[model samples]
Target: MPHDHQNDEPLSSSGHPFRADDDTKLSYWQVMEIAVRELLIEKGHISASQVHEQINRMDARSPANGATIVARAWTDPQFKAALLTNAGQTSRDMGFDIGPMQLIVVENTNSVHNVVVCTLCSCYPRNLLGLPPDWYKSRAYRSRTVVEPRKVLSEFGVEIAPDVQVRVHDSTADMRYLVLPAKPAEANGVSETLLANWVTRDSMIGVGLPRAPV
Candidate 1:
């Protein structure tokens, strides 16, 4: 029924006449609304306007958002430290949202720059990317990832410099994580878009670093 939206009347299915049961005690206005909708259905009242809308409402920057961030850090040490020190706010600064996961950034240090392990489980930052890949959650990866991240990275073909420190992080409870994968020395003056392509979910986890050239 044509909603006299002006009066704020509840619309019936398109344009059905209002119907009211004889014995029902609903107020006249309420009964009319029910009747109108019933009539609309009984007779094809005007076609219900399909309220077209989009469902892919989430704004995911990219899986490479991690890479882009790390790349940004490599080029700018202070920004890198900010990212390493505060993953949540810096992520928001880079046009990504990691606040809900209660992000915490752990930096690599002289003796132990960090690498992460959901040693007990696979808790990852889904808002920035999507679901954790199966391997990240698997016992094989989780159990072995912490014990020997460098070895795993090597098999995946990632060879961390022996001289550089490698700290390990275990994500659990309130915190979720993304890696501040150390920037490549050669990635000088790289654009965020181009740099992101090099970033991969695995690289962020220290199983790999963004690919160097190709």
Candidate 2:
């Protein structure tokens, strides 16, 4: 069979999100990788390789897990305490085992304050928080998150009192952080699911927090 090399190129098909350019230097590495991987699969160099599928399924189910976690924290006082003390423990208490990178949450209350940053490098907590967005890791975020957290937070629609001290953290290791922002006064007794919907990723990053529905 005269196989069309170009047609049957990237990862067993076309329409892959990334294209395999044959002309570039990367093509050599790509071809080598493809050949080695296929051979490994054929020769049982690896066992049943269903990891990709499992990973896909895990990603698909992330929002539900996040929602469940968010709701419980909002409704339960003790649970919220646990989350503030140790974010990793809070995730586990909910029957969801966060692997590692034990997350520690800080609360922004009347007197105490907190801000999250990645100074040396971005070492976000991947267990409790899957992955930080592109912007979180950007130089701009790292630079500004520490200097003027309130200003940046305002961009995300959070307003801070002038008296509060913004304590910025340097994420130098694998440890990540999230902020247990003060519950909006209007959201008291809100359903867990509804409250969870209000908790946005930006809130966890300490840039923003959930709000009562308008």
Candidate 3:
């Protein structure tokens, strides 16, 4: 999707989010990336087939991978410890390469709530959770999550008690975070597969919780 380059107006005259700029205008990096890719293909340095394969690999990843890990952690104490200690290796053990980026798994407890955000950009644990949500990449979320996490989470319908402490984690290019949301009370006696189904993409991102099974 194309990003608008409007700087002055908060909202457009139509009362919608301002996107009055020309859609065809490309950012410097976007132009550079296209130029570089075309140059590489032109020189036969990399084949178009290789690029398509990489794109397919990325598209294959989804929240189910992260949810599987979370479900295991919820049921097995040892695995949970291993996940918290070395998230990268744990993910690799499950056949997911999290690349060189460090993955930090934060546990949401009864007294403490955890939320993750990348203030600079949309740095996320994409290897396990696929892509970051559009709202996560929004400037408002990146800025507001750190300042008023409780209120921000409340806006997402994730309410916490006044006594509960909210810890907001800032993800960077070198490191990313995944939230291990507290297992729902109703999830007791549920199979791991079913439990995995209960987890949502937003839950791993800490913007929401796992859905209760109907």
**Which predicted model would earn the best lDDT?**
3
Candidate 2 Cα deviation (angstroms), residue 149? 2.0
Ranking by TM-score: 3, 2, 1
Residue 90 of model 3 has an lDDT of 86
- Order candidates by lDDT, high to low: 3, 2, 1
Top TM-score prediction, candidate number? 3
The local distance difference test score of each candidate is 0.68, 0.70, 0.87
RMSD of each: 17.1, 8.2, 6.5
* Model 2 C-alpha lDDT per residue in residues 132-161, reported as the tens digit of each score: 678888898889887778888788777778
TM-score of each: 0.62, 0.72, 0.85
Q: How displaced is residue 133 in candidate 2, in Å?
A: 1.5
lDDT of 3 by residue, 13-72 (tens): 655575566868899999999999999999999988999998988888888899999999
Q: Of 2 and 3, which scores higher on TM-score?
A: 3
lDDT value for model 3: 0.87
Q: Is candidate 1 or candidate 2 better by lDDT?
A: 2
